[model samples]
Target: MNKNPVDAALILVFLYPLLKGFLFKFSSKNMKSDIEEIGGYISFIIGVILGTYLTKKIFMIHQDGVYAKIYNNIPEQIISALESKPLLIYVLVMPIIIFLIYKVVQIIIDLINSITLYPLLDSIEDLLKGKSGFVKRIIGLLFQLPKGVCYVILLALVLNVLVIIGVNDTYNKKLNESKLYGNICKNIINPITNSKLAKKIPNVINDSFKIVIKNSEDQPGNESGKTIVYYNGITLSEGIKSNEEIDSFSRELVKNKKTSKEKAKIIYNWIGQNIEYDYDKVDKILDNDFTIKSGAINTFNTKKGICFDYSCLYSAMCKANNIKVRIVTGEGFNGSNWVSHAWNEVYISEENKWINVDTTFYKGGNYFDSSIFKLDHKDRKIAG
Candidate 1:
């Protein structure tokens, strides 16, 4: 009557080593060999995980300078070709680093096991020479438990990833029916991932990669043949990436705010007061000198950016507070003349409607959820 074939399969996988030990008659030599094999596999898994962690840390801390110096000399054409797929950099570089670290750790563990570990086990076995059969079997099972647990953890991780990626609805449903998998994810993986520390972990991976989907219909302000690239499920001007500083700062800014409207208003005030309009960069951009970098990270760090930067930073902060916001590109009347500009449209859950916000013009007037916002701002394209 139990509806858990997946759990049954997992249980068998977990007991595979114990069954192996039984088949080998629980000899000290066989037990020692199995433990050594498990140790090696465990070491490899640790290496892979550590390698991935360290690689992400290294990139987060030193990606800008290191990446520039290393990739600076590449041909512009090649760089341009790869620009459309920035995710490729992580895909190609991360694996090599992980493999090297994994190999090094595996070799060290192998050497240690060969030279000292096996001999130590043999010595222990000699001392327990006259142990009762029951005791020996219990010890053997105890030794095999690590391998069994490791297999279960690894399988749980794989299944969790499959569910995240949404490979197949039926497959995911079946995997979810496994109580063992659910418990491991809920009790172990989820706690670790949802912890405050994990929440604050830099969006380095997200920053490095943007999932792009082309918009077919023609929209104003968005140039023809341009693909819509998204970062963290929000539409953004190209090159706007988030980081740990921005993530933590955004959360801190909204920690005390009660409502989404209140959070959005306070964020608006902070940006207006803190982020200075970079007139020089704006002039350069207007002159077609597109060398300056501007985005959420840039604005958060330098406190200087134009309309696009303002809107991107605003969207990122609002998103951190669970507020639905999108970067809207259009023409805004700048007193003297209407010019190409970017702003935000925030969805207020209380009102069940989207409202306009232009943090760039925050200094001039109340641009946060104000009716006057529509008078100067003309609608164009919402970054999808």
Candidate 2:
């Protein structure tokens, strides 16, 4: 009849084992086994609580330090993997550590039990064998309650961590509605989370997400690629245009150009000098009020577009001139912060190399084949 039925249900769940243990009359052998089972549960509870705490502390304190130490030594491919999911490596590694801790604790408890605890439990069971059911129930209840409390505390700690790591709104709402769970969180879990170690947890998660966005290359199926493509995590439409117009314009742009590198440079400089960044489109895109009005052709005709437009237009021109090129979508630094941007990586047959080109940043400086080009332009994926 409690107002909080969910809380009542949880209480019943925890007490069910106690109730069952007391209600059923076990043989002497079964009682000894049950007593042994309690020891195993205690060892398990200790392992889970202590193992989780230790694992969290190690990562919270040393994760960034570990990342820094290994960053320079590893290959760029592996560095990209780390940047994509900074916490994932820790998640994978923690289970092994926790398992080792659990095994160690189990071994110690087994040793102690063999030495004295098991014999004492056996003597106690013998005394209880002739006792009334009511007395047995009381003792069983006493044994079960402590274990139940530990289970509740462990559940509370897990819930708090889930909240900090940004659990789903619906789950959060349901959890908040549970008065019993809320109290457990506030009184029991909040103190531990209020510590300096706990405060760093959210920061670590946020920083990891930031690193993923900053360093991630645009890949065909990457979620980070989608995030870095447009404002407010919008996906940029591919700036598709017919070869006819691009071919005609490219031929004029690279008139009498001797080599592929020459043609690529001409197209890069032309897009940079002529096409203006469409600030209006950026504002409308952020508000989700913009429509894709012919990606490449619109930009070519209007002489304006965003980073995606610049890259697309450049790519079209390069293809017209038979240069191997791709539209790379990823985050770009605009002096202060990284944002969704696009650029080009053109393959120069003469140099036998691929170089970055950012026509969107044309006015900023010479981004074409610049050595420091990768410093800002994170190549996420090839759009074309």
Q: What pairs collide in candidate 2?
A: 217-380, 218-380, 218-381
Cα lDDT tens digits, model 2, 53-160, are 554444322235653454355577754664465454345645566677767877887788678756776787888877898887777666666556655666665665
Best by TM-score: 1
Overall local distance difference test of candidate 1: 0.64
- Per-residue lDDT value at 248 in model 1: 85
Clash count of each predicted structure: 0, 3
**Which regions of candidate 2 fall more than 4 Å away from where they truly are?**
1-6, 25-41, 63-80, 87-90, 154-167, 187-196, 199-384
State the weakest 10-residue window (summed lDDT) of model 2: 202-211
What residue runs in model 1 are displaced by over 4 Å at the alpha carbon?
A: 58-83, 86-91, 176-179, 186-384
Question: lDDT by residue for model 1 over 212-262, one digit each (tens)?
Answer: 366735857877877675432344645356777787888998898788888
Evaluate model 1: give its TM-score.
0.47
